[model samples]
Target: MSLTAGILAGAAGTTALNIAGYLDMTVRGRPASVLPARAAGELAERAGADLGSGETADSRREGLGALLGYATGLAVGGLYGLLAGDRRLPPPVAALGLSAMAMAASVTPLTALRLTDPRDWSASSWVSDIVPHLAYGLTAATVYDRLTRL
Candidate 1:
């Protein structure tokens, strides 16, 4: 039940994050980041899997990248569920912690793979990264709390 709740919470959070991202893009007139797809391609290559070349490869990378994001969100939520385990952190604390965790989960791998360096990000870049994550954390924590109470 906890796991189920966490996953549902994660889905809600992921949706919120995506919406936030799209909103930011609309507001700023910025193009979507291709880092996710690039990360997917890199990981696939390391694992000895060929995604092939050309448009089909690009399509595969994009799909796989999105799936990877979903997988990360769900896994993080699951871990949060297990760790939280009938204990409720304060709302602010929960949100901050979850956001930090999500950010780290998403960024650390990219950093390790040399795809991005958060340290080099500008203020706008930070804002772009953080806003959606904040949305994710707030929504996920709230949903998890609500679901666990049922």
Candidate 2:
């Protein structure tokens, strides 16, 4: 698939996943409050420090990682869709894709620090993160399918 098409598809998929996550939380009667945008902005600023020292090179690496990550997600999700009779397995594909992304992140060597702290993440945080990744995977797959017969 074309790069632009893939990105557009991925964005749509991410949005859908976000909506699904909010709905899931609501259905479970959990607090559906989003982290304050200001707080998120502040956290991003703090996270920026972790990205120390390789600004230009890191940007290129990140771009590559994102592209590779999307492709990996698409393959996994597409395979899941094909193999599993139930449609729900695509979520599992997404999970696998996300795990692969972590591996990709580890090997990419773009930044000085690993972006996410697994130890610091609660189960809820993990689920939240994975669900969106899965959405991205599925989106990538859908886009790829539309763009390429493969």
Candidate 3:
């Protein structure tokens, strides 16, 4: 429930999410999602940091996406800890709520910026998004629950 615990749990959760996403990609032979990286690159450009040439720019963009993802998880996890107080929701329910909240946090902004349009997303796209977030939520909630108890 503490801020430190939330951040540590969030980092773990984000790692789990990445594993789940990579597993899905391996199983389905799908390419990694480019939207987050692209968004990061755009943000960097807006911030005036010319990130270098072609492949280097791509690498930096990917790193930025990952950094942002972990940051988002830490922030959201802190919110969960703050809101849960002394009593917490059942793990399963909390996980789902966390997932939904993360999705809302992400998709809403992307949609507003026209970086992504969920309306145009295919079933597979939805699956890709949901699966990783579900992993993140489950791991986050479980870790937070354990850490708070300790």
Candidate 4:
């Protein structure tokens, strides 16, 4: 798979995932997850940059969290693009795989840094994480397949 196609497909897929995630949040009356923002804060601290205190940090944290999410999608999409033509897994299954890969990308680092734990998540929390990823995977896989013609 071409890097260009992967990037394009990943962006499209990530957009779809965000739409799904926001919709779920609206429907459930849930606040956005803070784990990513906190993770971003940790990364910033490690880089010797203060996110500042109070509102500024909150705002930047939120924005940076989203950018990181987008970057995750791009990375996964690039991987998917590289694997696009493999016939061992059909598009539907490949979508599931892609979604899990993205989820792992988010979950692993957060957990490793002691910022979050999936083990502590509730069922709804699980749903919150899974749905958007499913949306991402399905959307990305379909787009990747279609665009790359694999």
Report lDDT (Cα) of residue 28, candidate 1: 91
Q: Go through the candidates in order and give the clash count of each.
A: 0, 0, 0, 0
Ranking by TM-score: 1, 4, 3, 2
lDDT of candidate 4 over 33-141, digit per residue (tens): 8888988988888999888899999999988988999999999988877776444458778799989988898899999989877999999889989999999998888
Indicate which candidate wins on lDDT: 1
lDDT of 1 by residue, 55-143 (tens): 99999999999999998888878888888878988988988888888889999999999999998999999999999999999999999
lDDT of 2: 0.48
Q: Each model's TM-score, in the order given?
A: 0.97, 0.46, 0.91, 0.92
On TM-score, the candidate that comes out on top is 1
Off by over 4 Å in 2: 32-40, 43-116
The positional error of residue 9 in candidate 2, measured at the CA in angstroms, is 1.5
Candidate order by decreasing lDDT: 1, 4, 3, 2
Q: Per-model C-alpha lDDT, please?
A: 0.91, 0.48, 0.84, 0.86
TM-score winner, 3 or 4: 4
What residue runs in model 4 are displaced by over 4 Å at the alpha carbon? 85-88
Better of 1 and 3 by lDDT: 1
lDDT of 1: 0.91
lDDT (Cα, 0-100) at 52 in candidate 1: 88
